[model samples]
Target: MKVTLERNHLLKSLSHVHRVVERRNTYPILANVLFKASDDHVELRATDLDIEVTESVPAMVSTPGATTVPAHTLYEIVRKLSDGAEVRLETDGGENMVLTSGRSRFNLACLNPDSFPDLKSGAFAHEFDIAAASLRELIERTQFAISNEETRYYLNGIYFHAVQNSASGSLFRAVATDGHRMARAEIAAPAGAEGMGGIIVPKKTVGEVQKLLDGVDGDVHVEVSDTKIRVTVGPVVLLSKLIEGTFPDYDRVTPKNNDKQMLVDKAGFAIAVDRVSTIASDRGGKAVKLSASNGLLELSVTNPDHGTASEEVAVDFETDGFEIGFNARYLLDIITQIRTESAVFLFNDANSPTLVKEEGSEANALYVLMPMRV
Candidate 1:
């Protein structure tokens, strides 16, 4: 097989697909990427048994054939090559594949393409198109809250499903939680995605899909089945297996009647939380106290070994005095997700979960944070 492609094209395609290849594989072929050249294009495919990524790039194919080569090795070589250089790859039915660029040449061991495992995708039960920007926002707003705990496998990923919103009618919602905090984001559901069931997308898959959607405009095609989910963005296709465990009922955790409202500058509140957390004790647990009452908000943290710190910020609070303790890191996480200038916090009491929302926006996103003992 022989093909010639521009250095930039090959490098970009490799970067998109090679991330799926594992560094250490029980099967030798699993560590390599399958390259096939035919019909004026080259296809690159990589998989780690559970997830697969395939990308196609325009190339000049002099000979039509296929082979497998080390994914990282090839990527590094192409990355170091001079810009605008033409890269030539050829293998004449031999164990070694020849790579040639301007003033450079290298031979890499090749594996039989037949040895690569097939990533079978069954019939898609639902297919819809969503704006790339909206999809990316959904992932970014909720992915940070996904749990890293392995014991409760259900909390390790984002849960996606269709729901009815009173203000916006049909909506596609994404929710993630790790017991300490929970994040939820919604976008208008596409026309064809009415009765789709909920699916738990693994954290790794959500990250990869986020990368593909970065800086991308227009619509992305999404296909989902019972066991797998597939996303198509332009010339790239990403497939991932769904988490087998069921996600917990997140609605029950959200506070229904938190009427104590405290509105503060989002940026200022985030800065105050960060500043007080500096004096918090990592060994004793990083905790910060939030005391809010009519137009005043005070943040305080104390560590017996270290020192104590507090900061007062102005807010638009009219409710009676209320104080709450929470993990500093958790408060910062939810604050960062607020895109507006003001962050609105609703509290029932010191121990109840607090509800956060972006002030003055039609965007349907909410965050629930569980308070901790001081």
Candidate 2:
């Protein structure tokens, strides 16, 4: 296989696809990227069994053929080449592939392309196109809450499904939770997304999709099946397997009747929480205590080994008085996603989950955080 392409173009394609290949692989071929040079483009593909990514870039093919080379090694070689320089890859059906750019040359061992595994997408039951802006919001708001615990594997990805919203037609929702906190975001359902079965997009796949969405505008094509999902963003395509376990009914834990409301400046609240959390003992816990009453909210953290720290911020709290404990790291994660100036917090005493959302905005997104005993 022989192909010539601009260094910038080849580097961009390699960066997009090489991330799918894990650093250490039990199978040697799994650590390599498959390259197929044809007509007017070169197709690069990399997979780690659970996820696959493919991208095609314009190139001049001298001898159309296919081969495999270590993904990271090739990426590093091209990345160091001078920008705007031309990259030439040639393999004469041999064990070594020669990479040439300017005065730099490297011979990389090649693997049999026939041995590479294919992740069959099967037949998709649902396909849709969603605006890039809407998709970005759904992912950025909820991805932080995806659980990393492997035992409850269903919570490892964002749950996506469509539901009827009589007032606004149909809405597509993305939800993620790690038992202690939950985040949910919704957007108007795109055409063909209605009636689709809920799918759990794995965390790694969500991250890769987010990266691919960068600088991308317009709409992204999405295909979903019972067991797999395919997302096409520009010249890149990402296919991933869906988690098999069922996600818990999130509505049950979403508080709807919290009577007390507190409105605080988002920036002030986040800063105060972070400052007080600095004193929290790393070995003990990262809990911050919130005491609200009489139009003021006091944040404090106590550590037996390091004493205590406290700060106060004015808020619009009508509640008589209440104190609650929450993980400072979790609170900051939710706060970062709030796009409004004010953050609205609804409380039902100090023991129940607290509901959080942007003040004076339509509820397109919401967060729930369970309280901890300080």
TM-score of each: 0.98, 0.99
Off by over 4 Å in 1: none
Residue 322, candidate 2: how far off, in angstroms? 1.1
lDDT of 2 by residue, 1-374 (tens): 88999999999999999998999999999999999999999999999999999999999999999999999999999999998999999999989999998899999999999999999999999999999889988999999999999999999999999999889899999999999999999998999999887999999999999999988899999999999999999999999999998999999999989988999999999999999999897666699999987898999999998999999999998875689999999999999899999999999989999999997758699999999889
Model 2: residues with Cα > 4 Å off, grouped in runs: none
On residues 1-374, what C-alpha lDDT tens digit does candidate 1 reach at each position? 99999999999899999988889999999989999899999999999988999999999999999999999999999999999999999999788899999989999999999888878999999999999999999999999999999999889899999998677788899999999999999888987777788999999899999999988999999999989999999999999999998889999989999988888999999999999999899875799998876678899999998889999999988875778999999899999999899999999998899999999768589999999888
**Each prediction's whole-model lDDT (CA):** 0.92, 0.94
Q: Estimate the overall C-alpha local distance difference test score of candidate 1.
A: 0.92
RMSD of each: 1.2, 0.9
- Which candidate number would show the highest TM-score if scored against the true structure? 2
Alpha carbon deviation, residue 109, candidate 2 (Å): 0.1
